[model samples]
Target chain A: MPTSNCSTRSASGLALRAVADTLPLCIAVIPWGILTGALAIQIGMSPLQAQLMSLLVFAGAAQLSGMTLIASAAPLGAIFASTFVISSRHLLYSVVFRQHVTQLSRSLKVIMAFILTDEMFAVSEAHTKRSGQFSALFALVSGFSFYVIWNVATLIGILIGDTFKDLDSLGLDFAIAATFIAMTFGELRRFPVFIAVLASGCLSVLLKPIFTDSYIVIAALAGMLAAYVLGQEGET
Target chain B: MWWAITGMALITFFNRYAFFADFVRYSPGAKVKRFLSYSSYAVLTAIWAPIVFSVDTQTGFTHAGADYLIGVSVAAALSLLRVPSIVVVLTSAAVFFGIRFVI
Candidate 1:
């Protein structure tokens, strides 16, 4: 009974921390989710479909990629391949998370995997790395919070899509671009990051004609390699 | 719609589940960790660059209104000033929209 009580208390404590950690991420995700919903509708998705995509895939990049492929009438296999390539980063996330979250049960790991977006993974990994605390409950809380906000935002965007046809005309898409730019610049304080960015951009441009849909993956791999090499050289 | 949605969800789940089941047995090395740190940067920049440089209607690249150039400038300026992220986002959006309106 004492062990049971201790476990329960620890689980709740972790859940509380996860919720706290996810609050800021949810705020950012809301706008992106809404934007995605509006775009989905603009591109002819019904509200139900948009919300369902959000619920199931729970990945902004993959959803956008899938929608783009559908709009372009790409083959079903191509759509799946492209999304899988684009989302391969999640593999990296799982590898890193495994280091800290090894104690979690299989059921908990599966559920957490369902909700692990780039942002959630980043925040949770950082939290655990900094504090050396691995709480499956916290991860679940954060994941669920993000999931709720993302779907709700998608629903809101779908509802408002008709009312806001000028969203793109108003340059709302620039928000995503701006966010990326800000994030990049924030990392430019380091030389390895700068090199990685330059390498990826150049490689992607060069490979675009050859790889077409898979350019991003190639570019990312090239960038990661370049950064890794540079970091090793510096340390040596 | 249902078919497409379900198919995509299944693929996503498979992609995620494979990592957890297969790769979680060992910790990533220092090299892997270093590489992962900049993974998002590469992916995000790859996505952002085309949007920034490609013209809306044209196939070729042109700065034109330079919407991204201006928006990035505002963001940098705001960061330097230590303005809040909300402020930076709103300011950049306003700048982009205002430019679109005038030019």
Candidate 2:
């Protein structure tokens, strides 16, 4: 149990170690953050508002989609709906966290909940899954690293928006598509999961016109439900 | 807009807190765990399937679009080949524009 605790290391040491583990991801997020900030402006947020959004509401998917919706002058409700849908993944992350971070204080949990982004979720998930325990400080600093870098990158993006503007147009955003595709395939080692992917794909394409981004939530639930059923059948 | 931002932030936080709260003694079974684990994949695909194949960003279902498709395929192949993600991102962008220039 002593070994399981990260208190063996200093708090900053543990945090930095976690940060080091997450460095590669943090690097990948730099350009992504810059693009978000710059895109926020291009889509019509003032520099101050864009920066504030990064400061206050820090989810990448929500900001990106919210920006697009704002550009289209979508109703306030639609913007909120899409932001909620895009960020539905957080619910899973929170559930996953409960398994490892059960001992964290209430205030810590609330604060930790505030900075839950995809990158942070990935890092924390890997750590918790590996050790069967979690370091609250480690999670905090890792989240902080992302939080600081994200805001800094965003400001840089705003200041240099003109120069980097061309980079986005070059289809540089393809990386996101490719990255997610790769990650999805990595998780599809099981046959049932492949079926889930196919089902989700079909359902999303079909539901695109109707539910839009909300289809993602629906498709995810549907596939997971399918996997659950298949797994149950196997058990029997 | 500020109200909406606050609303979104609150909703996002609550979505996150929904599970981590102590009051909820929720533990998912193996079946549900399998399902929850795949949520990310399912959602990611759901969001991007349209983007990768769609010709136009706005109306993605209209027709065949090669530029992004080609770029994504190349990047996905490289990723499967075990290349780093940063490289995958840059390479895909280059390949996308390259194909466009050629066309």
Candidate 3:
């Protein structure tokens, strides 16, 4: 019994440490969360819907894309497809850390997977590399902390969004484009990646009239294929 | 509403949980890894490209508007400069509204 008690206490301590480490990244998350909520409302989502998405989906890029599709009155299938493709990158994170999580119980694994986000993965991976150990508590704490911060910021945006009118006219949706563009810059220097971006961007524009909302999925797949083909050219 | 929310949530969790379970210890090969590494960038470009530029029936592909054109150009330039994402967002937003105000 004393062993159990000791472990519990240490777990809480580890959790607190995780929170402290992740606090700095929270500053970056706040504006993103707020912008998501604001864009949801601008695109005609109810405050409830926006907050619920932040809580449930918990994916900024997917939520933003979903709201954009919803605003355009896109079909439900397109929304699901976009969400799947956008979040598929999480699979890489899961694969990378799967070997370390085998000891955890199924339920605990479920919780861990639920909160597996890009930021959480980066912080936890860094900790593991630095300390030469993996703490489930640390990873969960980091993820849940971001989760809480993101939702709170989303609520704040929802409140502020309700008070404002003509958000669309202000070109606030440009934030979505800007955000994606900024994200794309990270890998643009790689030749294959650059070709992929160019292929996907040009294909989507040309196919827009035909595919409408679902064009994203088609173009993204084409982009991946382009990258794969170029990757065979011997460029690392 | 619940349908969209639940579907998205489930898909996201499924992706994260894909290889976590002991039963699914499948490791992707090098080629697959290389392919998936570019998914985020490809998907992001696909999402925004159509928004910032589009096809006109009479003309070829064209920028959506001068405001969006300038705003997205600023975003691309800043991103190339390795600016922080949040700053890129805010600065491009300012340019967006600034252009709208001027025109």
Candidate 4:
């Protein structure tokens, strides 16, 4: 009876985990959405433009970078270029997600592609690994939920941004950086992973001078290459 | 703005589609799977190292602020202790804010 109960609990837990995995991404979207709206207003973007960007792009990093560039009165080319550089990581997300998401319908896949962001990708990938089950429906539900919450939060932020003008002074911005660091560190439990991280750090530092704004992309490629070589050797 | 956003969306979609098409039609080789598994660390580290190390400077190496160092130390310790992620985040943020206020 105890063993049977344990199995039942495990099965339910797996299902719950699938649902709960998306919760973090959804919660995180709210703060970032608010930040985008507030920043857009502060930078003189009209509410319509701010909302449109949030609705369409659905990328926090690119939107933030683009807004910063716009505020600085950078040329359109420069703004686009900077946004591209910051968002290049999405390419990696798309590639990784594609492997598991391919069996999904074309329409569903297209929609997932639009809503894919760093947190959503991380949660989705982790869920896949943990559950050992691939349900495109789950992925769609998680991704779509996150996307909706994000836009709603942005709208809220735009509506009430004036009331929270002191958000920066409160240092809430640091939460974003801290959250990512915590998440990454939690995931790094093995030596190969640790070494890959170190390699990436070194490469980013080494390449910063030469690559300027594109150092992150260069570092990611170099780190992946190094880790791949090392991981292959370990397997052999 | 429309052109740039649309272009980016297209490129991103294509990149994602390539992976689905490639892996679905043919399983990725062991080497590629190994690479993908290990790639997360490199990608994340690459993103964060710059922020932590270059928080003060624009391009070159410089002294990371005490709060930054303390925050990371606390974070690393919590990670090593195998604390839950949410706890680590909240504690580290609290530590950073406390230090920032105290000194």
Tens digit of per-residue lDDT, candidate 1, span A108-152: 778888988766765565456557766566667778988999999
> Which candidate comes out best when scored by DockQ?
4
Fnat of candidate 1 is 0.51
Q: How many clashing pairs does model 1 include?
A: 0
Cand 3, B chain, TM: 0.78
Give the best candidate by lDDT: 3
Per-model TM values vs. the true structure: 0.77, 0.77, 0.67, 0.79
- By descending TM-score, how would the candidates be arranged? 4, 1, 2, 3
Candidate that beats the other on DockQ, 2 or 3, i.e. the better one: 2
Task: Estimate, for each residue in B41-97, the C-alpha lDDT of model 1 and write its tens digit.
Answer: 676666656555543344644542577678768976774565544566667877886
Clashing pairs in 4: none
Q: All models: lDDT?
A: 0.72, 0.72, 0.80, 0.68
Q: Which residue runs of candidate 2 sit more than 4 Å off their true CA positions?
A: A1-32, A42-44, A68-78, A126-142, A161-168, A231-236, B55-67, B78-103
Clash totals, every prediction: 0, 0, 0, 0
- Please, what are the lDDT tens digits per residue for candidate 3 over residues A96-132? 6686688899999998998888668756765775689
Best TM-score goes to which candidate?
A: 4
Fraction of true contacts retained by every candidate, in order, equals 0.51, 0.57, 0.75, 0.43
Candidate 1 versus truth, CA RMSD in Å, comes to: 4.5
For model 2 the local lDDT of residue A56 reads: 80
lDDT of 2 by residue, A1-236 (tens): 77646555566577777787556556656776788888877776778888888888888778877888778888889888888887887888787677666777888888899887766765665566567767777788889888998899889878766567765665545555665665556445566667677677767777776776677778767876776676555433
